[model samples]
Target: MVLEKLSKLIAEHKDVDPAGITLETTLESLGLDSLEVVEIIMEFEEETGVAIEVNEKLKTVGDVVKLIGECE
Candidate 1:
């Protein structure tokens, strides 16, 4: 469920196809800059009620999923 929502959010924000997004997809590969990443993180936090700290560790979609899972 988290992956689905996150993928949709990323696809909408980046104007890409959600079907193309995967756990291994890197944020940089999607052309997401630091500010864009932060914005997405904030949006996800609000939606999921999971506070995510912006850091170097959040490089891939899987990373974010894992963090959200851990938080929950």
Candidate 2:
């Protein structure tokens, strides 16, 4: 489920290398601009049945994983 959700967001960039997207991959390195990141968070909420607030706090990919884990 996480892969599917992430792939949806990752698919936006042609240069995004799949192998580089580990749990530790940063959003900036993944080419996720602020708007794309918000869309990703929204997609995750819809996909995983989790509600995430759009705040300035979550600034990394690890932050996203932590938020999803908290939902679980």
Candidate 3:
């Protein structure tokens, strides 16, 4: 569920190919700046109704997925 939602979000917001998204994918490699990540997090929280504490250490897509799981 997390992967699906996150992939869709990235595809829509970042113009990324959802099929290219993988757990190891880094946000920076996707050309996402810090502000963009913040916006994505905000949108994610709004959509999931679950607030996420954006961690600076979250460097990979997998990290964010783990975060969502931990938060839930």
Candidate 4:
């Protein structure tokens, strides 16, 4: 569920196909800029009502999935 939501948000902001995005996908591969990433993070926080610290170690979609899971 989280992946679907996150992918949809990313796809909305980026030009890539959302169907191609997976947990293993890297944000850089999608050509997303820092501002886009920050927007997505804000959307996640809004939807989940959880404040997620933007971590430098978060590089993959799977990392975000894990973070959401931890917050819940």
Best by lDDT: 3
TM-score computed on alpha carbons, candidate 2: 0.68
Q: Where does candidate 3 stray beyond 4 Å?
A: none
lDDT of each structure? 0.85, 0.68, 0.86, 0.83
Model 4 quality (TM-score): 0.85
Model 2 ranges with Cα > 4 A deviation: 1-4, 12-15
Model 4 Cα lDDT, one tens digit per residue, 8-33: 88888886677989999988888876
Candidate 3 has an lDDT of: 0.86
Per-residue C-alpha lDDT of model 2 across residues 8-61, encoded as one tens digit per residue: 566655356555566677777777777887887787788778777766666666
Which stretches in model 4 have alpha-carbon errors above 4 Å? none
* lDDT tens digits, residue span 1-72, model 1: 988988988988999998898999998899987788778778989987887766677888898788778877
Model 2: lDDT to the true structure: 0.68
Each model's backbone clash number: 0, 0, 0, 0
Clashes, model 3? 0
Candidate 1 TM-score over all chains jointly: 0.86
TM-score of each: 0.86, 0.68, 0.91, 0.85
* Candidate 1, residue 19: lDDT: 89
Question: Considering every candidate listed, which one attains the maximal TM-score?
Answer: 3
Candidate 3 similarity to native, TM-score: 0.91
**After aligning candidate 1 to the native by TM-score, how far in Å is the CA of 1 from where it should be?**
1.0
